[model samples]
Target: MTVSPRNLRALWPLAPCACTALLCLCPALRGRGAEDGAGCGPLLKGSALLLAAGAGPPTLLVRPRSDYVCCHLALAVRLVPALPLGDALYLVPARQALWALDASKPEQRLLAWLRQQAPPDSCHLKCLQILKGLRDLSGRGLEGPLGAQWGRVLSSYALKTALFSVLLRGPWQAWQEQFLVERLEELVLYLRDCLRKRVLMHFFLGNPHVPEAVPVPRFLREAAPLNLLAAFDAATLDAAATQLLAAWSQAPKIIRMYSGPRHLRRSPALCRHVPEASQEAQSD
Candidate 1:
């Protein structure tokens, strides 16, 4: 059954009800875990604390500190199950690109102001690190109550990232600008694939009680490399990379007919769009 985007939106209202059912059905999906100690509870209590404490926007700009990472890991391990739905801080960094923040303060304000005026870089490695960390932690044999919690946390993060991408790319530029469109499309496909894998992992490893499991075919279709590659222009080696990412995203699970390794080993015939330098390198 094709799940239309409209149908997904329609399902939003039922989220609360679904969560309530999960709680009743799965006893393991309840209570805080070992990470939330006495002092930590009040310190990281609410979203208001982050905003009011002068913490900047919740983005990849924040650096991950030991304490902050510990706090997030705890929340994912503990608070995820009983509530099963809500935003939770996963990681925070100590420093950021000075430009990615408001430079109103006397201390680093000038630095931030200058950085914003500069041209944007292509790869934000800090953001990429956080994404990789999330993927690693979510797959690290975390199960039972903590698994459910981690699942919700990861899924929430994915959704937030998607929304942020949309906001950052805007409708006009997202469609018209080639580079921006490519970046945004890659991000969308990445997050969507992450959500699918995390959800499946949570159900298979963490909670057996989850009634409506996300279908494998649906995820495969959504993460299809060909479909994802369509977002890129007709030519370019990056198209293959896009396809690889899509396939890799679907590789973790045991899908009946898909042979991930075989696809990985066989290279597609180079299209005319391959760069001259790439062709030279391949020939050599």
Candidate 2:
């Protein structure tokens, strides 16, 4: 499958959907196209650049509050089964940013913000790619249910939050040193903790805390300690994780064959431009 990376902003029209804002991987994922103003200081920000940057700009900066600016985008994903995709939220420490007041509209850019933040960090990217590989290994079993069926639970959003929380709580470098299999187990265990608490907080700043300034859906706010992952029981949840691991042991060769290339181990995008990428290419 040779498919170019389509900006999530452009997608075929479908029924509207809502997904929670869960912080995923690292920020370095923003490639050359993205102009990250690390040295710009407070006076100048990337979001502010979005306006002067021109239309169809790769990213738009949304400054909802004074302290930080969230690089916002109109992002939507086309999944196999049709569903309403939601917004994403990201907190960049510096920048004057862009201005927009569509308060009348619902907030749905959390995923977009997440998609942007993830994959740039080598540590977070390393773990996510392996987990995603496991998911692909399991015949795409990772997305348990996007709230379509009874006892429906699990999605990339929740997993991202859990992964972020795990990486934040511990030293990311050491976490990366563990064998690939061990890292995957840690992810499953981390999700178990989120399932236990029934709460998944956004970790854009590398923490499990969600500041009041960040916008969240009414349910996310009112729900309090409980997260969207509260829908499943222990048995089914355990079964899902166990089954995924089992699949790996059941067929190592086949899973590795279908699994993504090592070069993209730290990239969440998963799209490999080349027809075949050897292990040597992965290390580069």
Candidate 3:
């Protein structure tokens, strides 16, 4: 019988739940050299996060000001436990936010340290934010044809990998020099290349495609190759690519610098064509 993610989450009380699933599904996070039973059979060293936006808790009223709406359920590989789930808990996301609190705390010291060491206001984030917008627009268009569950070709996990790859290629100051339009163009160009090449190497997998400059720590390498884009079993790649190009071509050229609060976001106008879906959560 095929067990859904919801079914798996239902078994959380009986087992380690998401942690166990990660060990079984992702080669990088299974059977390693670490203590046994806290979650996995042993300590898995994989750095990838296999967060899926499943039909889990929807429209969760996290606080008065914010209603925590999960786009999907999450299944983080090695990092969820190592990084502490709280900070990454925003939402499983068909395309949405995540709160870091969702991570487990016991094994997150190193991951937390690395996060602190990253440049707080780096251009990497600036460009990443735009790419995220592009993804949201693309996903919005896909809600119907691909169905709510399988609409997107790219996931937040994949976008972060692409952004980190850019960071690896640079003198950080160089990004600041590029205009916002240039940044978008640069990112879109690279993504288009990845799509064409059919390779978006998992950052933590020690894949042959990972850039040498990226500098993934040895401990984070899971010794298993996990392709981040394996989620799509449909023709979503071509569809998403078409949406991306259209969005890139039609998006307004924002003149504001990456350093400010004044700006207008642009895209292929996914909402312009598709009606918004109801935000109701899946019922058990």
Candidate 4:
């Protein structure tokens, strides 16, 4: 259950299988790493610093267009063949100030609990499709001139976590087509409240409401609930709240834009294949 710093190098082989490349998280930023410059400003404006495995002497600075850094991630699988679930726990770099000096101590010094959860139930695919559509539209500037402003404060993970929380508390039948609009409204409202309160708990950690089947680490079970919003500074938080309000007012239009006649015209077969089509287009 514990991986030494020396063996951390073994993880590199596995990285390329999942993503195009692996990037290291900055030891200085710890828990406060953002994908792009967003609101972090000039510090990440030009390049992302990726430290090599050992003593941080030789570093690689990638000048991606986004101007934000990626995080250090170690993948862990909790396989139970008999169960219907396939849970993956990602040991991301921790935020504690103490671990700021070392990136190699992933297992002991810098491990945070993040689970790649399975869908809540059989009904979740429809919910995921709806969520993914909203996200795709938002990236296309449905929420603002660019998604960067809101992206600075609110992450897609936060939104997904919120959606999962709702799914867990569901009556199961509320996910029907007739209640789709209401569900969307509720999800938006829930996110709005999280933005207002500046606290969104990670759905898997320290949650007793989670079913017995989901495997949570013992330390995380005892640890205080994590606030996903904790990374945002006061100014960025205020800006996020303001932008969310503006977006909330335009929610109807945004929803219409996504579920409108343009999308409605697509057959179920085409709709299901959107992810592949979009990926192929992106590659072109």
Q: All candidates' lDDT scores?
A: 0.32, 0.40, 0.45, 0.47
Which regions of candidate 3 deviate over 4 angstroms? 1-55, 58-121, 143-151, 207-220, 231-235, 253-284
Q: Against the hidden reference, what TM-scores do the models get?
A: 0.21, 0.38, 0.48, 0.46
**Clash number for each model:** 7, 17, 24, 1
**lDDT tens digits by residue: candidate 1, 6-98:** 434554564465445433433433345466544333324331222122254222112234554553432221112121122210111112321
Model 3 lDDT tens row, 149-173: 3333566657766765665565555
Candidate with best lDDT: 4
CA deviation > 4 Å runs, candidate 2: 1-121, 139-152, 175-181, 192-223, 248-284
Task: Report the C-alpha lDDT of model 4 over 1-284, residue by residue, as the tens digit.
Answer: 12344654655455443321122233322223385525544444544545444332244443434424343422222211110011223333223211111112222221121122332333344444555555444545434333455653555567767777776667667755545556665676677678778888865456666565545556555656667788666666655655454444334445455455443322322222124555355448
Query: How close to the true structure is residue 13 of candidate 1, measured as C-alpha lDDT?
Result: 61
Worst 10 residues of 4 by lDDT: 77-86
Clashes of 3: 24
For lDDT, candidate 2 versus 4, the one ahead is 4
Model 2 agreement with the true structure over 1-284: per-residue lDDT tens digits:
01122423342242232111111221222333336535433434433333224333224333333445553432222211122233332211111232211211122344344334434433455556555555555554344442232123444545565665665455434444334445555675666555555555543323325434446555344432534545556666555554544443423343245344453254332222222343235447
TM-score of 2: 0.38
Alpha-carbon error at 111 in model 3, in Å? 9.5
Model 2 / residue 14 / CA error / Å = 18
